[model samples]
Target: MNKQKYWLPVLGIFVALIGCITINTPIKAADTIHENYVQKIKAKKELVMGTSPDFPPYEFVKNIHGKSTVVGLDVEVGQEIASDLGVKLVVERMDFDSLLVALETGKVDMVISGMNNTPQRAKSVSFSKNYYQSGQDLLIRQADIHRYHNYRSLSNRTIGAQTGSIQYSLVKQQAKKAKLKGMDKDNDLILALQTHKIDALAVDTATAKAFIQNTNGLIRIPSGFKTSSAGSAVAFPKGANSLVQVANQSITKIRKNDLINKVYLPKVSKYMTNHKSKKDRQKANSMWAYKDFFLAGIGYTLMISALSVCLGLLLGIFLSLMRLSKNSWAKKIAGAYIEFVRGTPLMVQLLFIYFGLGIVVNIPALLSGIIAVSLNSAAYVAEVIRSGINSINVGQKEAARSLGMSRQLTMRYVIFPQAIQNIWPALGNEFISLIKESSIVSVIGVKDLIYQSRLVQADTYRGVMPLVITMILYFIITFSLSRSMKYFERKMGHSND
Candidate 1:
């Protein structure tokens, strides 16, 4: 009886604990399942889709009635999803490698840039069901098609693929014997193949076909590597199950209705057809046809440089004063900031502002670029101004103080006037450098000269011409600025006389 009583109580306690866990498990899971992504989209009524518009048939920029617009099969799908959800579809363009970062940073609501779903990517973001399936293929010159039958024949040859793409990983793994060249843009990779820098280019079947049809002297061959049906899919932030569920429903409808093959592909074919006409090709190939692209680039470049100069100058003066202050803490803080910014690269700073600081607030790309460039310029400008201040003779400061002037007045009236004359050339050089360095803002999708040149290259399929024009335009801008600075320098010298 004693043994039964003791054992019965222990068993009862164990049973009660198990019952509690069983009862609460479903409630915990239910609490975790939230639809914040869908709720946010609904509240805003805008579904932002991020894509890299270099992949033809999937996504690319097209000159539609004099305006450059993103149009392709992927865009159609994104539109369908937006329509079904009763929201407006807004497209944001950037580099392929930047898509995920854009999505994660909430800079975009989702990404659908011909992105393939892989195990590696799944850990970072959620993916809808495969919307379209495609096979891998190699693009080779027609003259060498017989020499290369498959991936094996390309051993010891240079193969090219888009950086951070599935094709890049595919080439790296299967074509281990082949030297791999990775480029960020498809237009560049195609140029590399034409110029014989790379023997073959690994791309999706659709993309290869699009290129072959539009450009002469290129043919596609089988890649001869096994691939799964995990082809192109829409990516969402992790735990965005609501968005994923809705996207999957849209994808299923698309597949069942044969929309991709019948509707989307045919529509894309029409765009490709229009793009490849002899008259259109001739006009587009001419650099003169893209004068507007260059002009817009120049405008944005000048704007970013101008704004950064004004903001940086004011902030630089403040920081320089802080560094020269007698307060140890202020000096130390300002010194540390300058050293840290100067030590790191402008590219890193741009990304951090666009993607890192972006987590707290949704910043537009152009504004982010401006903020980053302004902040970066402030540090260099601060140092330059500090050196100018230090270079002034201590006798001047003492003389002004002895005349019953406060330190602030001494700096403003006595030291500053001389320092300005001394630092004129240096300040001018800093401004000139700012104009060129502001080009780095293009990486974040600001329509600076560099970014616009890439777009022209993509649309024209002529790489070298766009680069040549961009270089010339940059030279003209910087040279003009240099001459203007010299004019001011001379005026200052005459004033000093």
Candidate 2:
């Protein structure tokens, strides 16, 4: 009695310790520690730069004569800032909206995404010197250019901008002001303009030129646009003053060297080809990454998803049987695994095993993703097995037991085969879910269909073609699975009849 009491308190303390450790650990939230982190970059000797590639003439990664290179004013300025501070540049590329989040996380040393310092972001990150400011404008076809008399001419016209850009913000404000239809995303913009889905677009002159060059048959209307009073600057997390001073001085150094004209201009301007008009170059950026390429990705997704579901089914049946066993510890272990996997977000689970596990253990990324997906799938699968086993009229198990059949013999010879045929269609549904969810694996570079489509879009800067192809591929794979499931369902029914 005394020993059991003593160990109970020790076990309680151990449990409390684990809870405290988990609670104290940092999560995906922004890095407030460096919120005032301006001083850290200067002292750290390692500068992390965050930029969104959609902004051109400012920050963009271009495929120059076959080699991909980051070019534009922001790149030129960011490199100088790192060199001046006696630190090396570690540039991080992400979506426009995510750039600020990176800064908020302190994952970035500074953000130079042609970002205008707004009061919202100011709460989290500090600002350095303003290098350049830009105003929004429109570039449209000459024949159709006259339609824009003012912001009102843009009304009812479809407009496009990269999500999270000041350009998008300005367009959204103008769309409300003039009652225009505005869409977010540079890719969406190119598609709208090329397909005549939008009458005109409202964006900056520089971004307009780059997008127009990226696609054919689209022009920027020279009239009917709003302006951006906002100015672009280097962003540091709040409370970082010393880093601000160092970065500001670096900008002053680079501007004087004429780096803007010499290096940045020629590199980006190479993509600025002369085109006749949008109609004449209709197929300009129309095709990329063969339709069959995504078909292969779809095939890969289906393959992994099918294998994972098969693995989950077997694991689920075994775990459920163990949960029904006489051993309390075995039941507890199975229950905990199911609860833990189901309680967490699938995305976090994928990242935890694929990326986080990489730090302590090394494994192929695809297998990591498979394990994450399988863990989550197994939880639901446990319930499915329990229900399937239950649906088999209890009299069947009773009669078998009465016939002198052992428990294991009855389960193997009688229960499983019928339960599987009955639940076969539901298993098909699980497989479909796994395939759709496989898109999350792309975050760890599995090169699944969705990731490949995005890479093609970024490289070519064409929005419509890659996505259109991807959709078709997904449809083909899912439709094929549905047909196969129904075929099996009918076969099962025929056997029963």
Candidate 3:
């Protein structure tokens, strides 16, 4: 018997085993079932629907007499669907893109926002019957209103769209000649449109109509914006066959009976009338999309500030010592740390420390945020302190040394005190800024003052109220501290500005 022939059979067996293992390990994730989907909605008595509220006409929270109600078309339709199914409706409002993520993450049973049906989306989620049809329209400033002739007219022109939506994909593919800036959400692109950061924006016609209601100085260009069957539907992840069947039947029955049209659809169309009123439109514009989500934002901001300031001071002091150190290793290492923090993004550092580094160190979430903020802040503080130290002149240290004092004693006794005195005002301003920058922390899940405000927004859906409160809170916190420091820095002058 040949040994090679015997080895070939053995090699085939090994290959077969590896192939089996690869298939069994799961190349893709199975769609997540809605959390507690089968646990009986009748028993739970609450049916949760996911939506992005910022898209008006489909779904939005309007400040009606100073109260926020879920009253848009999608909201009405969701309520009707819940009623028909004999379950109470519960809406969990979130960012537009997060709605589908929530639905697939099993946080929501269904999503009925004005979601479009596409094969790509269908691969991830199942769609129910279409409720409404809309088309992509271009939003442009009054200055460029006549520039668009058709979607082709958009070719070679700069366009902006929300990052994740099918609109983004469409414009990217069809308008290859078009310069497109994809932003985080619809609101960002809308702001860019107003600011003229981008020449135009491609969005759904209904959304364009809604934007006209809220904004001035912009009109939709007529010719190139062709209508498409942008059908609105209820969607669940694929593999949710039972849920899909239930939803399609529910939507079909609701559409056929005119309940979807009569009750749900009208709730949004009326807002088109109010768009003409300057006072009402301004009030509407005042309502921010993130208003409901601003609860922890205040605390997060301040925390970032406090942590950054505090950490910056401590670490800055240590680095300053190294900057003055005689040892080459100490100076090089300190230089490296300072350069790293100063060169990179403070936001990325904040995230890395929170999500990545802290996992291994086991620090409390608050402390981790503080530490990251501090690390970044300290680099700047180090430079500030070094500048202050250098400003004191070498004469003071030489004078102290001539008085029979050591180098360490000269710095401690003669130089540092005066350096601090001169830099006090500059340091105070930096500390105040740290508090303002802390607002970024709310997204990282730290429940500070801003975080509390987000909760208020979530409940009230009143954007300005919580934001006003957060601003007032921060202003009070920072202003009081600065004023109190005047007694210490006796020569310090206050600036009204």
Q: Show how many residue pairs clash in every candidate, following the order shown.
A: 0, 16, 26
The reply for model 3, stretches above 4 Å from the true place, is: 1-36, 40-45, 84-88, 106-109, 143-145, 222-230, 271-434, 441-497
- Please provide, for model 2 over 1-497, each residue's C-alpha lDDT reduced to its tens digit, 9 standing for 90 to 100: 33342344345544754663354234323343344444466567778887765567777655444344556778878888877777778776555665665554444678897787777677767888777655666655545755765456766656556666665666676566443444434555666666666666666666777767665565665545445345788988665766777777877765677666677667567544433677533434344324444555777687668777878878888887866677866666676666666767998777656444443355555787788778788887887776677788888889999999998898888887788887787778877777888777765546578755755566567676788888887878888888999998899889988
What do the candidate models score in CA lDDT, each in turn? 0.87, 0.67, 0.67
- Worst 10-residue lDDT window for candidate 2 reads 24-33
TM-score for each of the candidates: 0.90, 0.68, 0.60
Task: Give the Cα-based TM-score of candidate 3 against the true structure.
Answer: 0.60
Instruction: Please list all clashing residue pairs in model 1, or write none if there are none.
Output: none
Residues 1-497 of candidate 3: C-alpha lDDT, one tens digit per residue? 43342344345544754564354224224334544443466578877888766566677665455444556778777776677668899986555665665554445778877788877787778787787777778888888756666568776678897776767877777778889798755655766777778888888778788777556687886435433544777887556666566666767777788765586556566744556666755555453633434433544565567657776898898998888789866766677677667778877666555544432343444675677677777887888888888899888888899999998998888899888887787787777777766655544445566655544443333444666777887888889879866666775433211
What does the lDDT come to for candidate 3? 0.67
> How close to the true structure is residue 195 of candidate 3, measured as C-alpha lDDT?
73
RMSD of 3: 11.4
